[model samples]
Structure formats: C-alpha cells, structure tokens
Target chain A: MSLELAVLDWFFEPLQFAFMQRSLAVAIMVGIICSVVGSYLMVQRLALLGDAISHSVLPGLAIAFLLGVNIFVGAFIAGVISTVIIGWIHTRSPIKEDAAMGIVFSAFFALGITLITTIQKDNKIDLNHFLFGNILGVTVGDVRDTAIIAALVLMAVFLLYKELLFYSFDPLGAQAGGLPTGLLNAGLMVLIALTVVASMKVVGVILVLSLLIAPGATAYLLVPRLHQVMLLGAAIGVLSSVSGMYLSYYVNLPSGPAIVMVVSALFALSFLFSPRHGVLVGPRRGRPWQKLRTLLPSKGS
Target chain B: MATSPKIIVDHLSVNYRDVQALRNVNLTVRPGKMVGIFGPNGAGKSTLIKAMLGLMPVVTGRVTYGDDTLAHQLDRVAYVPQRSQIDWTFPATVWDVVMMGRVKKTGWFNRFSASSRQLATAALERVGMLEFRDRPIGALSGGQQQRVFLARALAQEAEIFCFDEPFVGVDQKTETVLFNIFRELAQAGKIVMVINHDLGESITNFDQLILLNKELIAAGPRDWVLTRDNMTRAYGGHVGFFGHVA
Candidate 1:
C-alpha cells in the first residue's frame, strides 16, 4: 500500500463517523482556547489554579446532573464561585494562595464524589466517561457547546489582556493604579473556570490540569515575549490534541490520557532540544568536556 | 501649592497577628514637603506607609488625602512598594511597567489611550530609562528597576506619593539619584512620603521627619524631631549605634 493511501485511510475510516468528527472539532477548539489563557495563567504562577477549579466544579456538576440542567453551566458557575471563595480565603486568612487552593480543592472534590456515590447508587453514571473523555461517545451537542465556550473564552482574554497582564505581574501595583485588582483577579479565575469547562469535553476531568499547564509551560521555556509564548502554546496545544487523537485511534488507548501524554512528550522534547535553551545541548556545544575528550586524540606531552 | 494638607493620618494602628506594627500613629503631610518617616528595623515605618496607602487591610483609624479619605482618593495618590517585595521576573518591559501608572488616570477598562502611552514614555525619559524602554523589567539592574517603578508612579501624576524603602539594595549613586528625584517632586509641590532607615542622611535630606518605633515618636521639622530625646525615644538602645554630633 502506498504511504499516501494509508494516511488517507486512517482519517477517512474513523472520521467518517459523526462522533469522531465531533470529537476532533471539540478537541481542536478546546486546545486553542485553553492554551492561550493557560499561557497567561502559567506566567502568573496560577498553574495549580486549574486543579483547584477542576476539583471544585464537581459539586456543581453533581447538582446540575441531579437537577437535569446542562452540566457545563453548573461547572462554570461552580468554578467561578469556588475561585471567589478561594480568593476571599487567601485575603482574610493568614494562609497563602497555594494553601487556600488546597483547602478548597480537596474538600469540594470529596463532596462531589460523595454526592455522586450517594445520589446514583443504582446503575450509576459512568464516572470513567467524565474522568477520561471518550471521543467515540461525544455528541454533536458537545461540539456546539465547546465552540460557544471557546469563543467566549477568547473574547474575555482579548478584552482583559492588558489588565490581566498588569494584575498577574504586580497585584499591589495594579491595585494602586486603580485597575480594580480584585475584580481582575476574579476575572482571571472566571476565565480559568471557563477554560476548564470548555476543556472538560475534550480532555476530561482527570487529565485537564496537565493540558492546562504543560503546553503553556513548555511554550514559556522556549519564548521570552508574552504574545509569542501565548501563540506557541496554542499551536502546541492544537498539535497535541490532533496527534493524541490519532495515537489513541490507532493504539486503542484512552483519548484523554493520550492527549496529556502527547503534551507531556512535547514538553520533554522542548526541555531537551528547544533551540533557545535546550537542556541536552553542550555548554560549549551543550555537552561535557569528557564527551568532547572522546572525540579528540590523547596528547603524550 | 495648595494650602490644604496633602495627607492626614489619625490614630492609625496596625497589628500583624500578635505584634502591633503601628500604635496610634498620626501624621500630616503638607504640599511641597519631602517628609521622611525614619526608624530602625521593626519600627513600623512600612506599616505607617502601608496604612496610609491602604495596602494593609487591618489598619485602624482614619487616613485622609486633601478633602477625602485616601481610599476614595486612590487616583490622586501613587505608591511605590519596596523593590524586594516584588517579583522582578514578571514578563513586562520597562515600558509596560511605566504604562501601568497611567491606567488609573485614564478611562475605565484599563485602556491605554494615545496620550497615556505618550505620558508613559515621557515618564521613562524623565528617569533616564528611555533607552531601555523595550527591555524586560527583570533584565534591568536594581537601580534601573526602581527607577522604572518611580517612573510608573510619576505617570500617575498624583498629588501625593508614598514610597517604602526605595533606597534599600541600591547603590550610593542610585540612592543620590532617587533622592534628587524626590526633592524635585517636592519642589514641584507634590507630597513625597518616604520610609527610610538612614537617619543621618534623612536628617540632611528630608524637610520633615516622623520618627517611629512601633509607635509615634515625633512628627515635625527635621531639626525639632531629630533631637536627642526623640532619637532616644524612637531608637531606644539603638541610639548608641549612631555617633552623636561632633
């Protein structure tokens, strides 16, 4: 078989089905949106904020499921509410930001799990589906929801780009400048929550945090400019999603973990070989003198 | 300069958990005055400034700027926090940092109108940092970073400015430059409140002094406030650390 024919066969065979097509579109959109905002989050040292929001959204999702409303709305609402609580706790309490996040995240996630177990004891919903996304099971509604959420996320990022940057870099400075630092910080948390909800369909809850942080951090190590870092991160995110989808399709692996693995691999490659500052390169040639000595002849003198 | 006092603090106090950082601190900064709030370590110097600037949440008593409370007058005042407290590696150019100062003066939504950016650039030029405008803040030396922050505060065009330990970690030459800038601002009729540790230098450079050691020691002209009695009260045992007048 020709190489072109084999490549064509893989795409056409699986993607001809509606669910696969929906999954690909949602994944790609989620990738682009999350990465752009995630770059800012990483730069601001709010990388773990995603994990906090992700876990916090569980109760919201659980309540929404019980009430039969759209789960995305519940997740978005819960994410924002939890973030606000965390911000409040960070200020009123002596605990730092990370500690506050830990307090809220664990408690909320445990509550969500308890609610799920207690509420749906008989023939419970597939927790695996939420924890690890199943591309083969995505519906058209999921794709549409992803597109709307992605657009909203992009708009928010654009609107608050400057203020967000200012707040992220210097909260006290931003506050003194009358930038409404609290509202902007809250806005960031909201943006993060929105990003999390948008990503839930593509990467699922269990692997969402990895995608939010890894690609953006990898881009950060490679690029110095803020805009360039954001652009590169988004590109990396999209590539990871596409390659991960393909790898999962072929290897019969779970799609969500596959995407995270691909993103992790990208980060590893970036760590070892990025032209800007690759770890594997020699000091002179990005290698040890001992290795260089092997290439040179021994001198008797 | 306006006849009204640029800053007023009444019965101000701050408690950092069990320790009281400030106790019943009161102060008044008139326009065109370069006032130095001087004290030894743990002297509540920073707390006084933080309370005035509303940075400390647990501040008690009242702080007013001109006719209104300082909180309401946030736009009319600018604060330059200590350099050591900030994240220098923040992904912002000198230009971006300076530009932030104008955000308050400008319209809502943190929009940078043409005039705002122009003012930012001009502020950088004033600090002799125009050449390094495009450089990231982390790449700049300690003095340059401090100057960038000063330029940011300048861009606010505020009536009152509060600085916390602007001279710490700075070279002697940079320190001189910063003081010169402070003098210029005061001469231009803006209130300059600085938290300083160099008492001898403060006596020479500042027009007024607020000597503090966890409580209000004195607040008046430097000559009257820097007396041996007040110094003894503020510094306590640390008075021996400084040589008396020859």
Candidate 2:
C-alpha cells in the first residue's frame, strides 16, 4: 500500500469507533480553551497557579459526585475557593504567594484523594479514571459540556483581550489609569477556573499543567505579542490533542499521557528550532570565547 | 479644563506590616508647575505616591483633588511606576505597551478607536520609538524602554502625571527628551510630579521640590526646598545641597 493510503487509513479508521469520535471532539475543545486561557498564566508567571487550581479541583469533583451535582460546577467552585484561600493566607500572614499556593493545593489534593478512596469502595466509579483521564470513555454529554466551556472561555478571552493584556503586562499602570484591576483580576480567575474544569476530563489534574503551560510557552518562543502567542498556542494545542488521540488509538497508549507527551515534544522542538528565540536556530549571541578574543589583544596588535 | 485642578495630599499616613512608611505627609501640588519629590532610601517616596493614588491603604487623612478625592478622579491621573516594578521580559511589542494607555479610555469590551491608535502612534513618534513599535519590549535598551513608558503616559493625555525615578538608567538623550516633554506638559497647565533620587544638576529642572523623610521636611520653590538644613534633615547630613550657604 502507498504511504498516502496508509496515512488516510490511519486517520479514517479512528472515526469508525464512537468512543474515539466523542473523545476527539472533547479533546479538541479542551485543547483550544486550555491553551488560549493558559497564555495568561504563562505571561503572568502563574504556571504554578494553574497547577494549584487544577489539583484543587479534584476535591470539588469528588464532592460533586457525592452530591449528584455537575462535576464541572463543583470543580470550578473548588478551584476558585482554593485561589481565594491562597490569597487570604498570603495576605493575612507573612507567607509569600508561592508558599500559600503550596499549602492550599496540597491540603485540597489530600482531601480529594481521601474522599475518592472512601467513595470508591461503594461505587462503580474508578479513582484511576479521575487521576488519569479515561478519554476513551467520554460521553456525548461530556463533549457538549466541553464545547460550551470552550465557547464561553474563547468569547470571554476575545471580549477582554485588550483589557487583560493591559492588566497582565502592567497591573499597577492599569490600576492607576482607572481600569478596575480588581474586577479584571477576578474575571481572569474565573476564566482560569473554568478552563481548569473544562480540561479535567481530558488530561486529569496531575497533567493539566502541561496542556495549560507547554503550548503557550512553546508559542512564546515563536511569537512576539500576547494575542499572537495565544493564537499560535491554540493551534499547537489542537494539533497535539488530535495527534495524541491518534497515537493512543494506534499504539494503545494512555490518551492523557500521550497528549501531554506530544505537547511537551512540540515545546522541546520549538525551544530548539523556533526561528526567533530558538536556542539552535536563532541568531547566535557572542560566546565566551568570542568575548575573550575581543578582550585580549588582536593578532595585529 | 479651565484652571487645571490641583492635587492635595492631606495628613496621609501609611503603615507597612509593623513599620510606619509615611506619617502625616501633607503637600499641595498645583497645575502648571513641575514638582520633584526627593528623599533618601526607605523614606516612603514610592509609598507616598501609592497612598495618594489609593494604590495602598492609608491609616490617616485623605488625598483630594478640588471637590473630589484623588482616588475618585484617577481617570485624570497617569502614574508610571519605577522600572523595577515591571517585568520587561514579558512578550509584548512597543505598540502593544503603548496601546495599553488607551485601554481605560476605550472602555471595557471595546476595541481601541482610530483616534486612540493615532494618539499612541503620535506619542511613540514623539518619543522617537515609532521605528521600534514592532520590537519586543525585552529587546530594547534601558533608555529606549524608559522612552516607551513615557510615550505611554503621553498617550494617556491625563491632567495629572506622576513618574517614579524616570531618570534612572536612562541615556542622556532620553533624559533630554523626558524633561522637554515634562516642561511642555507643565507649561500647558498640567500637574507634573516626579519622584527623583538624584540631587544633581538635573534638580534644576523642577519648578518646586518636596523634600521628604517619612515626613514632609520642606516644600516650596527649588531653592527653598533644597536648603542645606532641609537636605541634612532628609538625607541625614550625607547630602551637600548645591548652592547651600553656610
């Protein structure tokens, strides 16, 4: 068989399974929203915050399952609460923000694990699915939920692009210019929480940071502006998700780890080969040897 | 726009953790004059501006502008923080940074209007940064970065302007451009206040001076505020005021 035919067969065979179709749709939606919203995290140096929120959502998900409510809603509330708690701890005490995040996320993660373990004894639910996402098991409803989240997150990012850029770049300047920075900050946190909840079903909590951070960081090496970084990052994320699903289907690999590996691979590629800022392909700076040569007397001298 | 409003900081005090940063800092800054705030390290120079702009919580008195508090009228004020407070390595072009000045005026959920872009372009051109509009902020020289920030403030078109240490790490040309624009702004009946650490020859550019050391030591015309006694009070006798007479 021709290589082209083999490629087409590889791509089309996955559509034959309903699970693959649903998981692909959900993956694409989550991929787009995570990267788009995650650009804010990357530029603001809040990658750790993304990890914190993602982990903190697990307890909310477990509790929501217990209450028979929407896991997404519970996860979002938990994520937001964790951020507030972190802020409160930082402000009320001499503890810095990183320490605050560490304290809050670990406590929430521990509670989530304990709750899940206790509930698993009586229920059909598997803790492993929540810890490591079971993308192959995504339902049509999950796809719909992911789509809605993607639309809302993308729209909020679109509407508030300029304001968010100003706030993130220079918050004090934005505040002094009469931009309600507090409101902007709260709005950003909501967007982040929503993104984290939407992404939970695709990559789970432990690996969501890769989806939220790697794509944007990869794009940053290639782009010069925030909007461009977000745009490129979304493309990279979608490509990674689709290709990762394909890899999982063909190689029988775990879907979440596959997606994360692909995104990380893309980041490594960009880090080495990006045109403007790449380590290998970018303009070479003066090396130590060159500096020494310039410092010492020239051969003519 | 008639008789540009004056800024009155009255009996304002600020406490950071357990330390008192500022105490009863009273001063009146009027339009059409350039005021320089000078003091030694840890004298609450930055805190005074932050408190006045309501960026920090104050324990005592308030800052007002005519009938309204300064915080309420922040739309009319443009404040540039010290360079150290900003992360310059963030992925942003000069154009992007300059356009941020118009973000407030353009309102939320709205695109920047044509006139706003024009103003930003004009400000960039005025600062000789139009050619570098597409350049990332991290790639610029220190002086160029300072110029870009000044352009952003100019694009704000505010009535009251406050700059914290604008001259630090800037080239001579940037300093010249900054002072010229400041003088023009002050001459146009705007209130221009700068927090400067230097008491060198550039001190002559200020029309009035506010000497501070956690409290208001002296405030008046440059000569009066730069007296030897005031310098000694503010700087703990390490500073020798130029033109000071024994």
Candidate 3:
C-alpha cells in the first residue's frame, strides 16, 4: 500500500470509534479556549493563578458529586471562590498572592482528596481519572459542554478584544482612561474559571495549567502582539491536541499526558529556535565563547 | 486660555495602609498653564493624581472639573503613569500602545475607527515616534518609551493631561521634547499637570507649582511656591534646589 493510503487508514480508523471522536472534540476545544484565555494570564504574569484555580476546582467537583449537581457548575463556583479568597488574603495582609495561592489551593485540594477517597467506595467514579484524565471516557455531554464553553469564551474574547488588551497591558492607564476596570477584571476571572472547568476532563486539575500556559507562552516567543500571540497559540494548541491524540491511538499511551508532552515539546522547540528570543540563534546572543566566559565570571576579572 | 475652566480640588485627603499619603489639600489648577506638582520623594504626588482620577479611594473631600466631580469626567482626561508602573516587555508595538489611548473613545465591542487611527498616527508623528511604530515596546530606549506614552496621552485628545514622573530615567532630548509639548499644550489652553521631582533648571518651565510633602505646603505661581520658607518646609531644609533655579 502507498504511504499516503497507510496514513489515511491510520487516521480514519480512529474516527470509527464514537469515544475517540468525542475525546478528540473535547481535546481540541480545550486547546483553543485554554490558549486564548491563557494569553491574558501570561501577559499579566498570573500563570500560577491558573494552577491555583484548576486545583481549587476539586472541592467543588466533590461537592457536586455528593449533591448530584452538575460538576462543571460546582467546579466553576469553587474556582471563583478560590480566586476571591486569594485576592482577599493578599489585599488584607502582608502576604503576597503567590503565597496565598499556595495556602488556599493546597487546603482545597486536600479536602477534595478526602471527600473523593471516601465517596468512591460506594460510587463507580475513579480518582485517577480526575487526577490525570480519561479522555477516552468523555461522553457526548462533555463534548457539548466544552463546545459551549469554547464558543462563549471565544466570542467574549472577540467582542472585548480591545478593552481586554488595554487592561491586561496596563491596568492603571486603562482604568484612568475610564474603562470600568473593575468590571473588566471580574469578567476576566469568570472567563478563566469557565475555561478551567471545561478543560477538566481533557487534562484534569493538576495538569490543566500546562494546557493553559504552554501554548500561549510558546506563541509569545514568536509573535509581537497580544492578538497575534493568542491566534498563533490557539493554532499551536489544536495542532498539539490532534497530534497527541493520534500518537496515543497508534502507540497506546495515555491520552492526556501524551497531549501535554507534545505541547511541552513544542514549547521547548520554540524556546530554542524561535527567531526573536531563542537561545542558540537569537540575534541578541553574542558569540558563544564570550557568553560562556561571562557566565563563568573569570576568577580575578 | 481664559475659556478653559479651572480644576477645583476641594479639601482632598488620601490614606494608604493606615498611613496618610495626602491630607486636606485644597488647590485650583487653571488652564493655559504648565503646572508641576513638585515634591521630594514619597510626598504623595502620585497619590494626589490617583485620587483625582478616582483610581484610589479618598478619605475626604472632592475634585471637580467644571461642574461635576473630576472622576465622573475621566473620559476627558489622559493619564500617563510612571515608567516603573508599566510592564515594558508586554507584547505590543508602539502603534498598539498609542492606539490604547483611543480605546475608551472608540467604545466597547468595536474596532478602531479611521479617525481614531488618524489621531494615533498624528500623535505618534507629533512625538516623533512614527518611525518606530512597528517595533515592540520592549525594544525601545527609556526616552523613546516615555515619548511613546506621551504620544498615547496626546492621542487621547483629552482636556486635562496628568503625567507621573515623566522625567525619570529619560534622556535630555526627551526632556526638551516634553517641555516643548507642555508649552504647546498650555498655549492651546489645556491643563497639563506633571509630577516632577527635579529642582533643576527644568523647574523654570512650569507656570505654576504645587509643592507637596504629605500636605500642601504651597500652591501658586513658580516664584511664590518655590520660596525658601516653603522649600524648607517641604524638603526639610537641606535642599540644594536654589542653585540651579537661581
């Protein structure tokens, strides 16, 4: 058989399974939304806040299960609460936001673990799936939910592109210009919470931050504008997701981790070879021998 | 110049972290004047501007432009924060930063209009940063960066202009450009308020000075406000300011 035909068969055979189709849909949607939303976090240096929100959603997920509520709603509420507490702690005390996040997320995560470990005895749920994700286990419902979130996130970003850009770039300047900065800030938090909830099934709570930050950070290295970074980041995310899913299919690796590894590799590649800020070939990098000598800080000079 | 209304600051006060940054300060800033807010370090020059723009909560009193509270009419104001307040490495070009000045005027959920683009372009051209429009902001020198921000404020087409520490870390050429623009704005009957710490020859450019040190020490014409008594009161008596100004 021709190599083209073989590749076609390899791709087409995966689509024959309904679960594979659903998993791919969820992965792709999460990729796009995460990249778009994560661009804001990257520019603002709030990447760890993504990690905090993702982990904090756990207690909500456990509560939702206990109350028989929609896990997404519960998880989103929990994410928002975590952010509010982080804000409150940092604002009212000498402790900074990073420390606040560390304290709050760990507490929420511990509670989630206790609740889930206790409840799983009588339920069919698996804790590992929530921790690492089981993309193959995603139902049509998850696909629909993720699609709704992706649409809402993308549309909100589009409509408020200029305002958000101004705010994230320079909050004080934008606020002084009378842009209703408080409302814009609340809107950004909501968008981030929703993205985290939607992405839970694809990357889980612990690994979700990787999806949120890597693609946008990679694109930032290559692009010169926020919009360009977001667009290129979304493209990078989708490509990584699809390729990772295919790799998982052919090689029998775990889907979520495979996807993360692929995106991470892409970021590493960009880190080394991006035309502007890369390590080896960047125009700003002086001669390799001179650079090495400077790092060595010669004994007497 | 006469038609432009004066800004009325009525017994304003501000506190931060349980400490008073500014207190019971009352002053009027007339249009057609280049007004400098002169003070030593940590004297709440920034706090005063932030309070007027309603960027911070006030402890008492109000600031007014025309008949309404100044905060209510912030759309008519353009503010340039200190260079340290901004993230220079942000992923934006000079053109992008300048266009942010037009964001409020352009309104929400809309693309920038042609006239808005024209204003940004004109502002950039005025500041002589038009040639660097496509360069990322992080790549610019300190003076160029300040010039770009000045261009952003100019693009705003605002009635009142407030700049915080605009001269910090800037080159001599930028200082010349900034003073020339301040004079031009004053000549056009606009209110140009700058927070300047320099007591050097540059102090001569201002038509009025607001001397502050946690409280209003003086607020009047340059010669009146920069008197020895007021300088000693505001700067605690070891000031070498008179050397250059004299």
State the lDDT of candidate 2 residue by residue for B10-127, as single tens digits: 8988998878989898889999999999999999888998899998889998899989999988889899988888899899999999998898899878888999999999999999
Error of 3 at A192 (Å): 0.7
Q: Which window of ten consecutive residues has the lowest lDDT sum in model 3 chain A?
A: A288-297
lDDT of 1 by residue, A1-301 (tens): 9999988997788788777788889889888887888887777778788889988887888789888899888988988888888888997878998999999999888888787777776645656566666666778888888888889888888777777776777787677656688788777777789888878767777688888888888887777666677788899999999889888888988888899999999999887667655665523453645544655787994
lDDT of 3 at A256: 84
RMSD of 2: 3.5
In order of listing, the candidates' clash counts read: 6, 0, 0
Give fnat for candidate 1.
Answer: 0.46
After superposition, the stretches of candidate 3 with alpha carbons farther than 4 Å from their true spots are A286-301, B244-246
Clash pairs, model 3 backbone: none
lDDT of each: 0.80, 0.90, 0.92
Standalone chain B TM-score for every prediction: 0.92, 0.97, 0.97
Give the alpha carbon lDDT tens digit for every residue of A210-243 in model 3: 8899999999999999999999999999988898
The C-alpha TM-scores of every prediction are: 0.90, 0.96, 0.96
Ranking by lDDT: 3, 2, 1
Which 10 consecutive positions of candidate 3 chain B have the poorest summed lDDT? Answer: B237-246
